[model samples]
Target: MDTQATSAPAADVTSLPPVEVDDAEAALVEHYPRLVRIAYLTLSARLGRHRRVLLAHRVAQRSLPRGRRVPEVVEAGTDPAYAVVRLATLRGALARADRVDGWRRWARSAGNAVPVPPRVIGLRLFPRAGGSEELALDRALARLDAPARAAFALRGVEGLDEESTARLLASAGVAAPRRAVRDAAMSGVNASLLVSGEFDPCVLQARPTDLVRRRQHVRAGVGAALAVVVAAALLGVPGSDGGTEASGPPGSAQAALAQALDPASLLRADATAWQRADRLDFASWPARGDRTGDQALLGRALSAWGRPGASVHVSATAGTPSTPPAAPPRLLFAGDVDGAAIVLLYDGVRLVRYAEPLDGGSGTALDFARVDGALGASASAVVLARSDGNASYLTAPWISGVSLRDLLSPSAAPQAIHRAADGVTDPVPSAQAATDANCGTAGATWPAIRLTPRAGVPGLAPFVLTDLGDLAPAHLTYATGRGAVPAEATSADATAAWAHSACRLASVRGEGVRTVNTWAFADQPLPDGAGTAQWLCTRADDWSGDDHVLVQFLPPGSAPDTPAAVSASARSTAACGPLQPGVLSGVLWKARDGRWYLLGAGSPEVASLTATGGPRSTSPTRTLVVPARQTTQAELTGRLTTGGTLDALK
Candidate 1:
């Protein structure tokens, strides 16, 4: 080692001449790999190995000056050009690793900005793996701060003495050069290990990133770009507002709106299409709203549907897609309802409704719901207007008559409700109209729209639909006895069964419920010779393919319309639906004689029942009765005849 030149004073170091750009370039080309290795070691290890390798190369290549002469001063004991480029590379690496403060740091933290090294798409570069000794040395060096790493790399990789390392660290903008040298000494790594190929950036391993994911990202990016361009073009088109035309030449907006707003362009069904149609969905519905002929109103609706403004409030039920329609949709209704101009459109898969203030003010609202496979009862009605705790519906053409029935009053006769010439019914109190105090009360009335289908329509039945704060109301059905299939709540037994289960509908309000079915699963004689009790399971299926299962126990002598005691409830399960019709549940009951018993029951398929934990009991039958204290707890399971074990619903 040239100790004399290495130990030269700081004053002599500051007096060295600047190197020419050509000389600096030549030096960098000759010693590029060594410089990159130094930079790679000096960077913060938080950057992964691949990024560190590429960043090291980037910083080393950027070390050369743009001017004819490099202004950086040279250090003693090193080639003047090499020393200049080396110092630049060290400063660049340290700057990258330094902590950023203020707005730039905040921006990076918020993901609004990122200061990363240049990246090459679909390619990753990393240094080659090395032996255990080299790995241990690399890890130890990584534990030091950036400035200390630079000091250590200078001493170990470049064979520089401590004095020269300290001087170079200070020139690289390190505040505590002597302390950094001391910190580097704490790593205790053998200097020979630092020269291994493991730390060499030039000796790299190149691999391709996820090619399949890359293709997907590229396709998605292209699609998003195209959507943005189309939206921009639509917004820029002039004279597309109603019938007003711009002063300049006609643009694409006029042509687009002309095609979209033309009443002849909309797909409309014949007045009696439902009578002979193959499917009883929205496709068979005829245009019936009074304002269907108003071209201006139709144009506004079509424009908003295609490209809604920022002022428009858009909402969709779960699993409903909110994308713009690909072609002109069928017109179902367009009229003024309540205080808003409403438009209903269907695109075979989704129902889209648009509403704006009738007085031409703001507050436009758009709603969407999935009604893809609707038939018979499910397609009986669509909500026309909802405001002030009341809602109205547009009954289907096949619906011969509409009546209102209070679900809680099973014996009360159905009251006639009037409908306009266009098939829109008068506003009635919605389920949400019930106050919190009376929502689940026995005396509270739950009004449901009862639609009587036209005669001679096979498989068509009267549907009891109730509003749940969604664009489409949920259909309510009932099952009379064990193993009975669910159907419309039209029969005497079915109507009485729904009277007990109607109050439980409050649990699924505003959940985008599509259908609610009440099944009388079991009727077991109570313990202590008490009168028989009924077990019912009510399942609410939502539009998102998720179902909520609730088991209720109606004890003997309960009121006709009294709410049943909830035994067990579960969401997103197949316990009560057709997929797994068998259900097992248990509840602790207190008899009139002041005795406590653990009462358990299962569907007929459950061959045996077992109760364990706090109160132990087993029964070969589907029902289990065991004595227990009031505060006792237990786990129940049932074994089906098919050899499948079912856990108690919770």
Candidate 2:
């Protein structure tokens, strides 16, 4: 608020003469820009590491009345020095590391006291020495984001005052508090020394003076961890309501944003509209983004849809907002895979859009408001199985057809829309036909999209719903609207072919309206030609309505246990070693135990637990039969198909 005539040169502000006017209207200013700059540098240094630290440094007048250097900077006479004199001890530890990531991973693991998420570097205090000292710093300096580390190294490691530090690093508004700066330096120095194999500088070693603070190492990163176990394994980190996120980083709101959605992995391949998540607070379920019941499931699928190599970009601003924007809402995110970038937009949480690259690689922008309006018709409502959308997405009073999970059938590879009794003719009619009450597929008004693109598939042109209008493109960053596409069961021939294959596809549930009429139990007791059988009284067609199946599995030479317990985890683990080499290695199954178990072991990077498989896969044996068991329930209780499997890389 310097109320005087503005001057472009930094010299003018830096050379202000001492002048004060207490008058009410006497042109006045507080130099908030400089102060903010001070704060940004202070904090950025505090939250050390060279990654995209959100600090922005702006040149300012250096007329600080109380002139003194802040604690984070390294003084020339500091012990264990060099450019950063107070850290010679840190040099010793670096010699031992084989791979930086291994050490880093251990340092940031959940079990560690203060989860130092590899970013937020904290405090450091160096011992004094004569004029020249060698500060053996944690050379892993390569890891710290350039902005953050520079801010910290200059201020904390270079002995510059906050303003000088701010100017030095170039981003100003994000300065951290003096104490926090000290903490960050200490954290950095501690980590450096520990990793360097010196005196584990973090242990406080009696402090030898009135140096830093009292108890606490919240975000236990290696830097913090060194501070912790080195000094009581610093405790729990304060997360976003959990940990103190570096008092906001050192860049402009725009820069932090750029940093946040900086990478491609965060977005869909070349998506103009990518998705972004400001933070992962949802895993903790903060009250603001409530999204109850099915809404929650929708939220989960949408959020995880982005793939590392996805062309569409995605991002989100994690704030105090209550509910997230509706589907097809344009968003921004950490780039598709790298880190965070600012330009991209995405539908952050619910879906991943795949689009052909725009020329020069700007993603195709979607008109989100228009699209949101279209999806609006089915918000929290049940959608008919055959709702229409070809050119433009169909909008009307309806129920969302199905969960994304049900979209993909082997025959229905890209989609999970099961064959409705009436085919694509009347979704509402088919859903209503089941209960006979015509209550409209219960919430099918618009919320339940029985079929949408698989959580991460991509494309823009209309393919399915020939009955709808063409979807108009939105100007928003991401795909704005979705035109209705026909479910694979567009006709009887297609539906029948897919359904027949799904039905005949063995003991493991494949696709379609299939119910378990009976299950042929393998590995369990078998009498004559009959193996232990867990038969479902329900037939494949029972999937349409009140159909239920009976299931009983018996071991090959043993008597059937009155009740059996199968753990998807155990089965998955066994399948890796025990079930492999068999022809059925690739068969997919929804275990009676409730876990969706897949038959084959995939790539080494992913293939391990048998009970747990990727969301989709193929089955080797399709024909399976067993003596029918007489039971009322379609599936046993406590049964779950390791329902939440990781999405495949493709």
Candidate 3:
């Protein structure tokens, strides 16, 4: 368990599988070391800095063994680093760092408690160079002070961001206010002398056997840097000859690093493809890690294990049946969900652990599955997402009809449930495919509808809805769209907002704020235009007084007769008309059977209707590829039809 392996990509194994999934994995295993070697070489050749020396050490150790391979590194020119940050395991790596917590923690423990490797100890990855030798950059970079070296390297060599540079520097105890210290670093720093003088001493100390090679490598590196920098200052780097190294001069080594690592570099690399000075050479995306397979198994299993409607929601005060006579009532369980992961709690049959995807993949090895409740024989069953910020409750058994909104106050108590994938707000769709026809895109998977209600809204707070597919991602709209939502029927005072899946009140300031008071009731301020309340007739919908609330659209695809008012029966008509007695009074919630049940109690005519259309085919939805044993397509489709919109987020 080396520290490098503990929390890096190699250990994180799940995600929306990329194209050629198996090939990607195999390629990574086969070519990762070569990729690392190339990066180390290119960077060392230019800046000759060893700031990621520790990282280099880890990289070398992580190489695949004989007959095995590592994933190839995906070269992202400037912004390649940006994609890496999305990965949980990178832990502030200069490049793509996805979910690596498990590996990181494991690496730390392994490095600390385990014995060192035997002779020829290996990470086992092969370098890409024709010679196939590990790039000896560690020796090349060690000559300079950590800050000056990191500044020059991150900015010019590795091409990392200032913030990332600062982070790495800070971690290494080298403070330079991000890239600010670069100004003071470029003197005739004399790369050759430093490598020989400094690297010579360090190599002898760490790997005495490699002295001859270290000496040769360090000399070649320094000599190269001398040529590049001196040439830049004299003839000047191709881009500029503006002023001092401190000023905006392209010749400066510092400027080069900033240019190299800028997250946008890859995005703009093509603009300079033909130019030697500006062209970049690397793959423009995040690379796959070694543990991707495992990540998937664990992610999907926990989601099923913690069936929101099936599991019972219990409060801490709600003790279980099994508490010993003297002990506080606690619960436990050990039954498996048909070979799917089962988290048991002890109400002596009382509390149970509910699982959710932890590292973004599927698995049932009993590894990475988390659940709420106490530990014991129940330990295997209960994986606690600790309450870190405000005291929050973990889902004990995922009680029926309860939306997470009622259970969580995110901004206020974010850290409470420490182990959920992302958080309570990130809705994981049910495996059920409730409807009849193929509801989503032509073959692409779209997830179960996920609707989320606002956190503190009055009556509607407990239930808000949206197809998560509607998340507003800038460049990926087509890929992200779940549906299109029109504005909600707004009263003069309240600014109502309706996305296809959810609706909320956007409080406005000043005079307009005085209009829709939540207290009073009025009918048809649009007086002449009246028959009954319609979700469509925004004008006649609101009551006359300060509080002018009306039935907005019933369900996204419901009929005109399906009055906005919950009381009016689900109107199904071609004209899209309002049904009689169009006045629904409250919020929506799901029932035990999975059908979306409304809560407005006032009118008898109000009825739950099965609307014809599904979620607007706009916002991209999330889809699950459930393994045959865990759930059948029929079972999943059945779970989806229960709600008005098939929204699981709510």
Best by lDDT: 1
Candidate 1 lDDT at 590 equals 94
Clashing pairs in 1: none
Off by over 4 Å in 1: 1-264, 435-443, 481-484
Residue 368 in model 3: lDDT: 17
Give the alpha carbon lDDT tens digit for every residue of 56-115 in model 3: 434333332333222222222312221232111122232311123467867776866955
Q: What is the lDDT of residue 240 in candidate 3?
A: 36
Candidate 1 lDDT over 336-409, as tens digits, reads: 88888899998766788989997878899989887766677878798978888789899889888999988878
Q: By the lDDT metric, which is better: model 1 or model 3?
A: 1
The order of the candidates by lDDT, greatest first, is: 1, 3, 2
lDDT score for candidate 3 against the true structure: 0.25
Candidate RMSDs in order: 15.9, 26.1, 32.4
The window of 10 residues in a row where model 3 has the poorest summed lDDT is: 470-479
Off by over 4 Å in 2: 1-16, 19-178, 188-650
